[model samples]
Target: MSPFWITAFLDFSADGFDDGLRFWSALTTYDVSPRRGKVGEFATLVPRDGDAFLRVQRLRDGEDRIHLDLHVSDPRSAADRAVGLGATEVADFADDGYVVMRSPGGFELCFVDHPAGVRPAPTAWPGGHSSLADQVCIDIPASSYDSERAFWRDLTGWEQRESSVSPEFSSLVRPEGQPVRLLLQRLGEQSGTVRAHLDWATTDRPAETDRHVAVGATVQEVREHWTVLTDPLGRRYCITDRDPETGVPPKPPTD
Candidate 1:
């Protein structure tokens, strides 16, 4: 049940839908595609360089969060495999061509048969830095960390790469042509539902952070290697000091 392509969705509540769409498009340098769902609740962030992978969804009611849409050949079989792996079916829209399921740790995701696409290039900014929203970090509570991490690895059939610099983080090796990568982080808490957030790999964190602030993101926290910011709609994401072309964090200074 491996997916051939992956998409990251920034889902916002109805009250903040318009603002969320505008904020994301500006930050990621993508244009909003025409809305598609019955109530016009779904749209893709179309990049000028390649096939679209980032998307936005307007939720009727609920807090804004990041979720994944796995593009598979068989949605039904994929849903079944996920359920067998401790996931629960949330909704089935077979006729509409998708299925929604919540993982054991309660992270929501969808299985669809969207077409495979070429990966988009990192957007070059006026500040001479490139940035790519190429990763989704899944925050898992300590109690369910192992299970949740294993589930994603098995589901994606991607090799798990443990972070050398941080014991709490691990990531799935992204296959060629896949737009977004999956990262799993163990939270300090004992137990709770899993949550996800977007991560931008940038050549210059400071410049990217400044650009984001100028557009509308509020600095939430400035970490050693990553800066957390809240979007215009108050949704949280991070800008990391990573090579935009490779998604690799900078090595620490040698002793």
Candidate 2:
């Protein structure tokens, strides 16, 4: 198995970079790393107490979206494996140790070569909320749900299972040491495109939502165990009812 360090990225338009950086930093309680890249458009969010697993990019053009970066030991091998699993190559940077591809469902994924390291521990904030940005939920049309799920499972070599809380949700379970998990959510109707949003595992959903709202996010809706909030950049993310320390949903009690 090719070891992977899954990093979630928030890509924003050049015009939205400042606002995006400020909002995400406050929400996640992470400090912005010094800008890098030729145009100073890339940076990582540094956590106070753990390894960082989230980054921000300022795109020259295009709508803001979230994408995953897979840091592996061999970029070519991983990219080839992803291609065999129904992902198409979007760009290649072998010399630079990275390649970009689009998965079967059209979500952007990047494979990069990096040394294997320990997974970052989860972050807990004051007021009983935790921030993991550890899961990316792909919103797909009903027609593409099964195929998309199969594609991700084969691509990442991660276990795929239906969510216990909802039939429409399927989870791509990461390996024991992996930092990120993939979740596929079937929309009620066909959506125009397959897009991804970050999911934060929080111990307290209501308190987390309120914390985000205090930092410029607004509640879009409240579900049974999660609250969806739109960030200052208008991107939607969920504060879920999962343990902050383990990133697991509470287990059902045996009768």
Candidate 3:
């Protein structure tokens, strides 16, 4: 069976070997290794029933920010572990089973409660986990590799993953770990200001907005948290911090 990718990595400086080990310990319960020309390294916390990997490596001079979401069984607890590992909660909270987290590097990622954590196998879903949950990778552009990488590192506390993309397309990701991935890549005209926004599970929109604003995200539009806001660095990304019960994106105001 072909190994499918649950999460991609975010690349930062090629240092901090300890971070690599700590990351693995917190996310997966196994070893993450450099793949065979498959991009980078990969791994999983529990036993992997399908194909997944975490690619790690050092970064060059030019780079930027790449963001992704990681689904977990317990959003709150998983987030705490991330903080313990050195990542700081950016005040960005979602009522749903998800929380936005940043790595020590400048990459952005979230701890999501997938159907079965990383793998969505029906059997993978046990405890409180719903089914086979999965995090769809969403990439954000960075101004420069060093500046962006440092920003993500300070926030998430995770190190950079190695890059194996050919010269045609430049890529960066979190040093091969488990659970989720944070990736950043460089494209001549392919990169956009804001490709996509992250929507987390939440119950309240206004309340989540207040906290989100206090953390670093500036509220753009708050009809339902479906606002257009910029980060501390002026990067624009939208997020609707509303849960299913309390906040379900109101149907777009009929023009």
Deviation of model 1 at 13, angstroms: 0.8
Tell me the lDDT of candidate 2. 0.83
How displaced is residue 217 in candidate 1, in Å?
0.7
lDDT of 1 by residue, 67-163 (tens): 8999998898999999998999999986778999999999999999989678999989877889999999999999999999999999999999999
Clashing pairs in 2: none
lDDT of 3 at 255: 62
Cα error, residue 82 of model 1, in Å, equals: 1.0
> What C-alpha lDDT values do all the predictions have?
0.91, 0.83, 0.41
Best-to-worst order by TM-score is 1, 2, 3
TM-scores for all candidates?
Answer: 0.96, 0.94, 0.30
> Judged by TM-score, which candidate is best?
1
Model 1: CA > 4 A from native? 253-255
